[model samples]
Target: MDVDDGRTARARPSSWAAVAIGTVAVIWLAFWVLKAVFDVVALLFAGVLLAVFLHGIAGWLSRRAHLPAGWALAVTVAAIVAVLGAGVWLIAPSLAAQVDELSQRLPEAARRVADHIERYAWGRRLVERLSEAQGLPQARQALLGATRLLSTTLGALTGVIVVLFVGLFLAAEPAAYRRGLLRLVPIARRARAATVLDDTGHILRRWMLGKFCSMAAVGVLTWIGLSLLGIRLALALALLAATLTFIPYLGPVLALLPAALLGLLQGPAMAGYVIALYLGIQLVESYLLTPLIQRSTVALPPGLILAMQVLLGALTGGLGVVLATPLLAALVVLVKRVYVEDVLGDATVDQGEGAPLPGLPEQR
Candidate 1:
C-alpha cells in the first residue's frame, strides 16, 4: 500500500509538469503563428466574406432565373465583373479629376478653417499652442495618417488578387468545402456543425443584402442632397460614404469629415445643411432602412458591432474594421447555438415573430 501510494504521488507531479510544459508550448506557438500569419488569416476571412456574397447572388440567380446552379454561378460572376467594369468606365475619369481637385482644395480649406478659428482669441491661442508644439511635424503626421486611412485595407494589390481568387474558389464549390468542414467535426457533431454553417450563410446573405441596399440608398441620397446644396465633390463624397457604409457606424463618421470640411469651405449655412443632411440620412437608416431589412436578418447590437470594429481595427487595421460586424454576428450565432441553447437549454428569442434560430432550416 505504501509503494502504491508513493507511485501515485510521483506520477501525479510528473503528469502535472508535463501538462504545464505542453500548455506553455501551445501558447508560445499560438502567439508565433498569429504574428507570422495574421495578414494571411485576415485575407482568408475577407475571401470568405466575398464567397458568401457571391454564393448569395448565385443562389438567387438559380432560383429566380430558372438556371442551373453552375450557369447561375457563372452568370453571377460575369454580371459582377461587367457591372464593376461599367462603373469604372463611367466614373473613373470624373472621380480621378474630382480627387485631384479635392487634393488641391483640401489644403486651402484647411487654411480657411484655421483662419476662421484664428478669428476668435481662444482659437488663436489654441492655434498658437498647436503651432508651438512642432506644427510642421504634426501637420506631416496628420497627412500621413490621412493617406494611410484612404489607402486602408486595399493597400496590397497582391493580397487583393489572392483574396479574389480564393473567394471565387470558395464560391464555386461551397458545398464541397462545407462538407469538408463538416468532416473535421466529430461524427456525432457533424450535423450540428452543418446547421451552424448554414445559419451563418443565411445570416451573412441577409446582412450583405441589407448592407448593399443601405450603402446604395445612402450614396444616392448624399449625392442628390450635396448637389442640391451646391457642395463640391458631391459624387466623390457620396462614393466615399457608400463605400464606408460597409464598415457600419464608424464608416459614416469617417466619410463625414471630408464632406464637412468641404462644406465648411462653402459657408457656415452650407456646413449646417451638410451636417443636417448626414443626420437625416442616418436617422432614416436607423429608423427605416435597418429595421425593414433586418426584419429577416439577425439584429446585431450597435454597441457590440462598434466594440468589435475598434478591437479588430486595432489588430488588423482597415480590413479588420470592414469585417468586424460579420465576425461578431457569426460569433453571436455560435454562442447562442452552442452555449445558450445547448448548454443552458434555453430558447433564444429572435427579432422577428416566428423567426427560426440560427442553424435551423426555414420551413417553406
Candidate 2:
C-alpha cells in the first residue's frame, strides 16, 4: 500500500507536466490561427463600425421623425442609397476621366522629378543611392507588381461587399446581436459587458460622424484650393486628399506625395505653392475643423493614434492602418471603462468627452 501511494504521488507531477505542455501547445496553435484570420477579423470590425454608423442615423431618425426603429432604419438606408446613386451618376464620368488623367500623368511627373533631381550633384547621388537600394527592378517586374496590386484591389472590393452586408444585418437588429454576444459573458459580468458595448458604439458613431464631416470639408476645400492654384487634375487630387485624410498623420503625408510630384512637373515655385496649400489646409483642419466637429467624440492622443497606425500597418497592411484609429479609440474606451474604473476601482478616470452617451439623457 505504501509503494502504491508512492507511485501515485510520483505520477501526479508527470500528469501536471503533460497538462501544462498541452495547454501551451493549444495556446501556440490558437495564436497562429488567429494571426492567419486577422484580416477577416479586421474586415468584420470594419463592418461593426459601419453598423454603428447606421444605427446612429437610424436612431436619430427614429427620435426626430417618431418612426419605428425598423422603419427609420429602412428610410435611412434608402435615403443613403438614393443620395449615393445620384451623386455617382452626376460625378462618375468626370471623376473617372480625372483619375485616368492623373494616373497617366504621374509617370511623366515622376520622370520629370528624377530629371530635376539629377541636375544637382547631391540630389543625383541621392537618387542613385535610392535606385541601388531599391534594386532597380525590370519593367516586367513592375508590371507583375501592378497586376498583383490589381488582384488585391479586387479582393478588397469583395471584402467591402461582405462588410456592407454584415453592417446592414447588424444594424437591423443590434439588440439581438448584443444579447447574443452578452450570452458568452459570465452572468455577473454581462451587465458590464453590455455597458462597454454601448459606450464603444456611442464613441465610434460620434467619431464616424465627425470624420465624414471632416472628409467632406477637406475634399471641397482641396478642390477649391487646387482650382484656384490652377493645378491639373483638381478633382482627382481633391478626392485623393479627402480619402487619405481618413487616416491621420501618415495619410496627409502620402496624399501630399502625388500632389507634390505633379507640382514638380509644373515648376519649383508651383511645387512650393502646392506644399504650402496642403500644409495650410491641414492646419485649418487640425485646429479649427477637427476641434469643432469632433467636440462630441473622445480626444484621442495623436501620438498614440500614429503609433497604432505604424504598428498595425506593419502587422496587417493597409486595412490595419485604415482601421487603426477606430480600433485604438475602442481600446481606449475598454481600458477606461473596464480596467481603470471597474477593475482598478477608480471612477475618476474620464469616460469620454463632449456629449453624454447616445440615447441617454444628458447629465446635469
Residue-wise C-alpha lDDT for candidate 2, range 1-364, written one tens digit per residue: 9999999999999999999999999998976776678789899999999999999999999999999999999999999999999989999999999999889999998888788789999988999898887785688779989999999999989999989999999999999999999999999999899999899999899999999989898899889998999999998899999999999888889999999888888898999999999999999999998888656767788899989888777667899999999999899889989997888777756744564554469788
**Model 2, runs deviating above 4 Å:** 1-34, 125-143, 351-364
What's the TM-score of each model vs. the native? Answer: 0.81, 0.84
Clashes of each: 0, 0
Q: Report the error of model 1 at residue 141, Å.
A: 9.2
What are the lDDT figures for the candidates, one per model?
0.86, 0.90
Can you write out model 1's per-residue Cα lDDT over 1-364, one digit (the tens) per residue?
9999999998999999999999999998986676467777888988988999998989888999899888998999999889999999999999999988988888888888999999999999999998787656778889988998777655688778989999999999998999889889999988888888898888878888898999999999999999999998899999999999888888889888888888988788888899999989988888899888877777788889889888677666787888888888778888878787778776745435577766779989
